[model samples]
Target chain A: MSQAAAAPLPPSHREPRTERGRRTHRAILDAAAHEFGTRGYHDTGITHITARAGVALGSFYTWFESKEAVFRALVADLSAQVRDHVGPHVAAAPDGLAAEEAGLAHFLAFARQQKLIYRIIDEAEFVAPDAFRAHYETTAARILTRLQAAAAKGEIRADVSEAHAWAIMGMNVFLGLRYGIWDDSAATTAVAQTANSMLRDGLKP
Target chain B: MSQAAAAPLPPSHREPRTERGRRTHRAILDAAAHEFGTRGYHDTGITHITARAGVALGSFYTWFESKEAVFRALVADLSAQVRDHVGPHVAAAPDGLAAEEAGLAHFLAFARQQKLIYRIIDEAEFVAPDAFRAHYETTAARILTRLQAAAAKGEIRADVSEAHAWAIMGMNVFLGLRYGIWDDSAATTAVAQTANSMLRDGLKP
Candidate 1:
């Protein structure tokens, strides 16, 4: 467990770098994401990522200590990017459902862009576990806060909270799993429609 | 795929097996379940299962053709048990929200009793994927039909259709994933409440 904690960055002889060094670092991450997207986190090797990035093995060590570190950094970067992409959609919308619909559209588009996240969530069940929940909790928390704002506006259900946030987050994950893994083409539209319906109507049966 | 197409037994293996054979077979299944639950399907070995059961290797092979056969048997047995247990609760509930809530309770109880379903879902994500989708799709079909029934009864929004049905099913899956993998103590109640809220209220602002 301590090792798990140590993984985020841990201690490294790796020097923090300027733009050129950062360029090298970003290259490693981009290459790692591509490799992970294809081979999966568990099946992929550091050598594979380094080789694909066309960087020396020592360069990877300079950026990250373990494969887990590389993965964690990749995930962190992904979250930041997702949040950045989702932020405006949520902010620009006028109402709860509208905001949610817009936010979800952004998420789905982002999900399409980053097959890496899909791969991580998929294989996370086996390989780099806790990453799913860990990735999700942060995402869920932000979503809850956003929904809470709507509740304050008396637009959505005031009672909705973290639990609901997590549940819906799960919905997005499963949607991706179904469509991405199993190649559900039209099903993706069906999923989007469902999410839109829920965002608009809630489950008022 | 052929065996998948093979007509399923009529939800029973009660061909009046001899007591000794039945007992030994049960022991093997129990051991295999535990092995798969703990070590995962891909990671568990036939020897470990046999060792755990205190049965000879020859005996294990006698009862099952291979590890897949053992896993298939266990999954088939557990899937039937879950369907049987959930059948009444799902039937008793008359509306979408009620059905979803009853389902949450039944699903949690089913997972508690069969603890292995959790492992099976997790492991099957990689090892026995078709099995994962088969059970979930079957369960999803049941839920979809129930939701449709509720809609027919005017218990839910008429506009919601098979797509919403799939979302409900997707919601349950995330519930199981969270409860099983994250070790979150608040999960069962949280997801149940969330499901209830989502079904009854939607995320409308």
Candidate 2:
């Protein structure tokens, strides 16, 4: 998760005042994820989102000001969703290495279910650069914290640092892309176990 | 390092038959790298590439059919460039693990010098999907070959598999983005050494 707590809608986004409004807000964001993920930022429009959301044009404006605003929000939403979905699995693990394995396995499962995730997040690089950077930065920071805590308890090496966190994040991200998004032939647990062993024992003969 | 040998220009591309033509072809590709790298595929034009290359309008057509064609070719060209540039350094290392270290170190330097590389390659995911997939698939395949060879020699664990190769590639790629593209403050060798150490000894206390 990001160092910042899960924030409510930012200033640019108008916070829904009632349960109905909140449902509308959530609907639009989910619809935006599908439209943007399928049609891409350039091809997707506010009407596309509104149409898919089954919300009135006025409702989209009630929450988001523009196509860019919604896209940015969706990126953050997806980032948070990944963290929330995988955080529990990671916390349930027996140790640091097992936590990583669980995190990766859960992530792969999430990616498989939400295939549009890769497209939307990848598109953020061009559509919203700050969100893209923040997503990775915060994700790496969270991983760093976990590794440091693990090291402190002697669960892993004492020299764990930010680079190691980034390395692990990289591993999980690519593995998710290959085994989760591209092809589902490989078993998620099997993949996670293979990667976990490498982390646990290195490659030394 | 693709399983297939570095190929001559595919049929879509007109291979220059003479030295002067070859120079023109090379110039056009380098110019495409800069133009597409900067302006991106949608914003860049054939005229822009030709203008940057300082080649005649006819010469652009002689080498490439359209902007999309050139972008596809550029992805392949950059892929080959990375393989060729990093291959020698990897080969010069004494063993499998050290070779990965050298490969990463050299890649960081290369990414620093060619900062446009990340932008172009990332954009290819949307602009030219096949080429983008080919770049990574071939790269992972090459890594798998190295790991299998190392395992056979008793330099690394015999259980090394395709998953291990993807994990390593992911590590190098993300590390390169963080230390190489995002910030230059970190020492490349130090970062590579840190990551290499994890691969060498795992994270056990």
Candidate 3:
């Protein structure tokens, strides 16, 4: 997460208003996503975001304290969707692969809506690490908990230990990265389908 | 990779080099890994690095150029290990899981060695979009080639396609992130062993 929103440059100034303020805030965020998505977080600037958003420098501060703040918000929003998609379905899965696919669906949907945020969370390690690590640990724990619950209920396979559960969670995250977030090439659909199929069938003899 | 490393804030003054220069360079990079592993890329700075390295500001320039330069160098150095490991092995596998596991082992070793880089790569969607996409595409293509080669050899199952190979590759990358990079704590050796077993076996019924 960036403390500054736009890379190293000062975020542009903007006029304040309740409705317009919210609008400007959202625009700045969306622009930040675009910049982060296109130009990259490190390469992007606050000025770039405000310019894209058609806002003033002052307006950025009014909305987000820093790029990191906006980034956190971005991750929080996406995680919320992931949480929505994952929280229940994962708990309901009857097997390891089933659990994984349900969780993957959440991540895929999250990636579609919050590609920027997901990107940040995914890349939090490089740019804003503490925050990213925090998010990952939290998210991993949640998914693990759900898996544990399923295990308890005899829904998730009992043979899959808690630790292996995390690896399964890792698979879910990586699958989303391949299929949803980095699907820019449009050739990943088959990969997604087959991998998902493998997930359902169990990848062994 | 980052362009010429952003020159960090200049030292208050310049200093001459000695044998300590090599030692300090090593120290700086070691410190850099520690810093990057813990703090992330953006939050860390030359000042932080130098402080950790116990070298003066000017010394940073002697070894490398910018924080990003260090990062690139770090990632490059790490890639050497990754390349050495996975780069050569995927070519050797005679069958599906064998090919995947050969690649997976290399990825796991890389993650274990440079956990931060894998974390960053996984998160490239947000932190460094261009680089992440580049790596993703390049890696996918590389795996696709291997799959094609296997196809030529008649080693690949007729059921698996080029895209499925790429998704398998994606699964390997994700496995590294989920188990190796995301804090070795949450998961366990049993989980890894089991997952790796499945990774080699896959969910193919």
Candidate 4:
């Protein structure tokens, strides 16, 4: 526990101008993700993140005012990572259904490599409630937008709503947890294909 | 804050035989749920639980050896609570898809009352790793069994698999978090109904 944990962090951290400074910022955020993901938010400290990133204490303060600020940034960064990783696959799909399957497949693959995403995002519910809510809310909103677009394009059901978006998001998240984080014995594509079928035809006999 | 946080607890707690003992045990557990749910496992103390239950220190130790024991028990208890609450509704539904709808509706309703359930169960991942894994594994297993039975009965798609069960479970959970815990502006029936429509017929246009 550092003094940083006790104080309120600034709304945002300093934006690094130089390439070297940007790399240091990225390194700190990456290390914070691992530290917070593995040890949890409360148990992780500023010093630990600095040590993990191989950066000095003063350098940390230059980018992040406190542990909380870095954590907030990490949540945003991870959320972006999921989007950036899945977005291309989704964009390449020919239809809404294929887009969803591609999204799930890419997400599961991403989850396998970054198992800490679940932990850090979940812990944000306790440590950073706003960030936690924003992450899911933003994600759900994006799903809703896509579903509506697909509906307009006649690529999906006409009755797509926020509830449907939440449902699909939930399905993807839980599947990722079970297959992606808990165990990877099952093929990622197989799992995605199974869930995608349900998303396509549902459980109708 | 107590030594109990660091010390290893006995594997299991003593079972109460007498009626009075059972009553006391139940009270302690209820109090423990509130304390752990509100304050978190690491921050919560046995004294807080005892104080909340209005039971003496000795009474707390009578049924549970340490804070860890009670936390583990609470995890199991909450898991059972979800099952017990959702089971009757699921059983009463006329068909497999209807059963899932009923189950999700009931779960959302249950989550509204037991809002802290997500916090406590999720925190178990860090505080009690085995308990956390067991909670989800058991839930997913039960879901798979039901889905398989429905498939055999020709109620749902014949190709239903464990992946389908996990997907459905995930949908119910995220929907619960959003509609159940985050906000109650939307009707539970409406939320469940919308998601159920997707389960009955997916997003195909």
Candidate 4: segments with Cα more than 4 A from true spot:
A1-10, B1-11
Q: Write the per-residue lDDT of candidate 4 for residues B1-205, one digit (tens) a residue.
A: 1233324334678878999999999899999999999998889999999999999999988889899999998898899999999999999999888999999999999999999999999889888887877777778778888888888999998988778888988898999988888787788998999999999988787
lDDT scores in order: 0.70, 0.89, 0.59, 0.88
- For residues B37-147, could you state the per-residue lDDT of candidate 3 as single tens digits? 677676788888889888888878877767766765554444455666776676676675566666666666667777567644443334444544555555556666666
Q: Give all candidate RMSDs, comma-separated.
A: 4.4, 2.8, 9.1, 5.7
- Worst-scoring 10-residue span by lDDT in model 4 chain A: A1-10
Q: How well does candidate 1 match the true structure in TM-score terms? A: 0.83
Query: Over the full model, what C-alpha lDDT does candidate 4 score relative to the true structure?
Result: 0.88
lDDT of 3 at A94: 66
* Interface RMSD values for all candidates: 3.7, 2.7, 5.8, 6.1
Model 3 segments beyond 4 Å from truth?
A1-65, A85-106, A149-156, A162-164, A182-192, B1-77, B86-106, B119-134, B141-157, B178-192, B200-205
Better of 1 and 2 by TM-score: 2
Q: Can you give the DockQ of every candidate in the order shown?
A: 0.49, 0.67, 0.21, 0.56
lDDT per residue as tens, model 1, B64-153: 878987887777767778778878887797666777787876777667667667667556655665666676566656666777777778
Model 4 error, position B21 (Å): 1.7
Model 4, C-alpha of A87: deviation from truth (Å): 0.6
Give a tens-digit lDDT track for model 1, residues A63-155.
898988787777766777888988897899888767766766667767766766765555655565555446666777787888898899998
Instruction: Give the lDDT of residue A1 in candidate 4.
Output: 12
Instruction: Please estimate how well model 2 matches the true structure, expressed as its whole-model Cα lDDT.
Output: 0.89
Q: Evaluate model 2: give its TM-score.
A: 0.95
Best by lDDT: 2
